[model samples]
Target: MYQPEEIRILIVDDEPSILKFLSLGLRNEGYQVMTAEDGLSGVNAAQEFEPHIVILDVMMPGMDGYEVCKLLKDIGNVAIIMLTAKDEVEDRVKGLNLGADDYMSKPFSFQELLARIQARIRNQFPHMMGDVQVGPFRIDDRRKEIRYEQRVLSLSATEYELLKYMVVNHGLVLSKATILDKVWGYDFGGQENIVEVYVRSIREKLEDREHQLIRTIRGAGYRVDLP
Candidate 1:
């Protein structure tokens, strides 16, 4: 089991209260916690602190979360959880599209936030560490890479996790709630529609190659059919 003290978390928010509150809670949980007031500082802290996870606020004064997410992604291998005050789908989608591992709307419970952080960390270290071949899809868990029909897929961490889960459970219809619990972690506290957004994104990439592995069972959820 991984210890909380082994994990370092960086919290980036413009609000002083949020920073103090989250920092205190995370520290109490035994995680090494760091904070930054804005996106630029967040980027700097990411480089300096080398945290395993980052809690980033979306609506900052300058250099919003989307841009910050992109920059951090370029820095590589760190998990990001984007925070947004609005419940707009576009904002969430934008964050995910920019490679954020997850999103939490403002006024979120610290318990749920902690759960998300733990879930993301759990995903980083899977019990299985090799490649999985299911139908036309090949998943390299160690490298965090996926290939379909001899072509590589450019997937965000969340998208890769969702696809890998579906592939592992191929031929079974997985409900949105189950996917959320398994892929996004339990009690994610976000709308189930976020699953649809990621599914569509994966479909657009996979189906564009004229290969359709994921099947939608209307009113049920989704399944990846074996080729």
Candidate 2:
């Protein structure tokens, strides 16, 4: 079992209250917490503190969370959970598309936030952690790398998670709701179209006319047909 004390979290929000609240709450949960006021400072903290996970606010002054998320993704393998005040699906999708591991809207309970953090950690570092080999695809969770037929595939964090989930459950049809729940966490209240977006993105990278690794089951969902 992974201990909370072993995980370090960075909270990046413009709102001082949110930073304080989340910092205190996460610390109380035995996690090492760091807080930053703006996206630039958050980036600095991420580089300096080297947290395992980052809780980022979508709306921020100067450098926005999207840019921050992009920078962080490029910088390290830190898991990001975007926070938004708006309940818009576009916002959630945008964050996820930007490599955010998960998202949470404002006025969210601390318990829910904690759960999201833990879930992200678990997904990133599972207990029975090992690489998944389905056909020509190799999903490496620890290194966050994917290889197809000896060629490396460039995938975002969210894309890697979705692909790993499908590869782990190869030959099984997975509904959009189930994909959302597993990959994005149960706190996701956005439309199922996000799954379609990620699926298309993954297919573009991993599939071709001759090798169709993923199949879209009409009226059912999607499945990764292993060779």
Clashes per candidate, residues 3 or more apart or on different chains: 0, 0
Question: Weakest 10 consecutive residues, lDDT, candidate 2?
Answer: 125-134
For residues 14-118, what per-residue lDDT tens digits would candidate 1 score against the true structure? Answer: 999999999999999999999999999999999999988999999999898889999999997888999989999988878877889888998899998987786
Model 1 spans > 4 angstroms off: 127-227
Over the stretch 107-132, how does candidate 2's per-residue lDDT look in tens digits?
Answer: 89888777677556656655334565
lDDT of 1 at 205: 83
Candidate 1 residue pairs in backbone clash: none
Error of 2 at 151 (Å): 35
TM-score of each: 0.61, 0.61
Ten consecutive residues with minimal summed lDDT in candidate 1?
A: 122-131
